[model samples]
Target: MINVIIVPAFQDNYLWLFHRQGSDAAYAVDPGEAAPIEQALRKHRLQLAGILITHHHADHIGGVNALLQQRDIPVYGPLSSKIPAVSRPLADGDLLTLDGGEISFRVLAVPGHTLEHIAYFNPDEHLLFCGDTLFAAGCGRMFEGNPVQMQNSLQKLADLPADTTVYCAHEYTLANLKFALQVEQNNPALLARQQEAQRLRAANQPTVPSRLSLELATNPFLRVTQRAVIEAASAYNGRPVDSPAEVFAALRRWKDNF
Candidate 1:
């Protein structure tokens, strides 16, 4: 089995460590800080195989050089810009295998958070590592791409298997769920999830690895077509929800100030 560990880094960012249970080989995803990752590797007695980067953001690739200083590991990421020391440039449709037969991941180009943002999917494990593209209850801000691009990117992720586990780069679920509750106040699933998240946070626990089915039911950004979400966005924008694209734009604008 593939064992995944969350190494909290840089305020709220999560550097994912993946390894085959019973093996020393491990891989890290979006390691923003190398010190913590290095420490974790040494503590677990694991060997770094490669690094998977979702984007070129400083918070995501800040520790590439430091990690490389320790080992000559292959770095895989988009070809959009300089990625520190990328040994292999990956694009959409790229397939990567790691963790000694425990994990096999496929890369999908999911832009909008950034024009070059990509997500890694492990079909066998039903896991998705989406970096700032899709959050638990909300989507990423349109810093580089437009609402349409972001909507398309989110839709691409939403198309994955309903049970796929979503591993976001940041711990923004509580805030995102609060915003979602505003738009979907009557959704019991959302309300219950918010309560559960509250409990988790109160206990100082990690409320991550949410299931795709839960997101589909409660995430406002992913529910643009739902009647309640469409109506809420219409009320917020003072316009009719004529199309999915318009609804997406309105929701994004609402979340910007929300």
Candidate 2:
């Protein structure tokens, strides 16, 4: 059994610490800073065995060198010149073994937020550590890849099982949900989700790792084919949305200013 610990970082970033239930060996995912990760390791009495980088963003790979200074562990990340300390440069379909085969993840190239952004997917575990490609009721802004590429990447993720738990790298659920509700005002699922998210935030709790099932039903970005979402996106764009990618682009741009 693997226990995933959420380490809150600068502003809303979430640095994931994955470890076996009864073992000391652990892997850090997208650790933006060293201090929080170091503190978590000491608090849990865990060993830093490896690190997983999802992208080359400063907020995601900033702590790599500092953590390496503490312990020289293998860094598994995309093959990008921007990200340093990547001893194991990975690509799509690459199988990553960590903790002596105790845990395995399949690399998926999900470019949208960044050109070389990747996700670690464990089919057996039904988990996806997607950096910024897929969020809870939201998707990342297109920084490097175009709308078509981002839509395709999101489609790949949407094809996964509905039970897959998405561990996004940020705590943008509430803000995303606010925009989602605007796109789907009459959707009971979105309204209910808004209520639930409000409760979680009121308690100062994290609302991440949302199941794909819930997101499929409520997330506007994933529901481009749906009539309501298409209508909303079309209205917002002041034009007809002929394709899923176009709808996704309209919605993304709408969210940018929302």
Candidate 3:
């Protein structure tokens, strides 16, 4: 089995380390800084096999150069010239096979948080390492892509199996759930999730890798078509929204200030 461990960095970023049981080599995804990652590697005593880049954000690729000094590993990222650290430039439909196919991933171009953003998914494992494109109870801001683009990108992720374990890049669940409650107060599943998330955070635990099923029920960004979300977005924008993408834009703006 592939063991996924959380390596926290830069206040909220979650640098994930994936390795199989009894394995000495592993992969690091979005290592924002080298210090904490180095510490984690030493503590776990695993060798860095490769690096996975999701976007060109500094917080995601800041430590690439530093980490390269320790071990020269193939850095896989989107087919964008912006990220020079990526040795293997990949795009949607590409497959990444590591350890002679012991671990494999299907690349998905999930642009929204950035125009070049991408995600990795293992169908057999039901695991999704979606960078900043998706969050537990929310979605990323439209930095370079439009509302329609982001909505469509989210749809791609939502189309995955209900049991898909989403490993997003940040620990924003509690904060996002607070805003989610404001959007859909009557959502019982969201309320229960909030309580559980609160209990987890109260004990200094990480509230991540949430089930896609739970996110489908609680995430307002993914529920723009729902009656409550539509009503809330309409009210917040002081106008009526005609389409799901329009509602999504309204909710994103509302959350920016919320």
Q: Pick the candidate with the highest lDDT.
A: 2
Tens digits of per-residue lDDT for model 1 on 1-258?
Answer: 778888999888888988888888888888889999998998889999999999988889998889888587788888865575777788889888775555788999998989999999998879999988988787788889887788889999999999999999888889999999899889999999999999998998888878999999999888999999999999999978747778999999998888
Evaluate residue 154 in candidate 1 and report its C-alpha lDDT on the 0 to 100 scale: 93
For all predictions, the C-alpha RMSD in Å is: 1.2, 0.8, 1.0
lDDT of 3 by residue, 1-258 (tens): 789989999889999999888887889998889888888888999889999999999999998899999687999999788889999998999999886688989999987789999999988788999999999999888899989889999999999999999999999999999999999989999999999999999999999989999999999998988999999999999999959889999999999999
lDDT of 1 at 157: 94
The collision pairs in model 3 are none
Q: Model 2 over residues 1-258: C-alpha lDDT tens digits?
A: 778999999999999999988989999999989999999999999999999999999899898899999687899999998986899999999999888898899999989999999999887788899999999999999999999999999999999999999999999999999999899999999999989989998999999979999999999989999999999999999989959999999999999999
How many clashing residue pairs are found in candidate 2? Answer: 0
Q: What are the runs in model 3 whose C-alpha is more than 4 Å off? A: none
Error of 2 at 2 (Å): 1.2
Whichever of 2 and 3 has more TM-score, that candidate is: 2
Ranking by lDDT: 2, 3, 1
**Clashing pairs for predicted structure model 1, backbone only:** none
State which candidate has the highest TM-score: 2
Reference-based lDDT, each prediction: 0.88, 0.92, 0.92
TM-score of each: 0.97, 0.98, 0.97
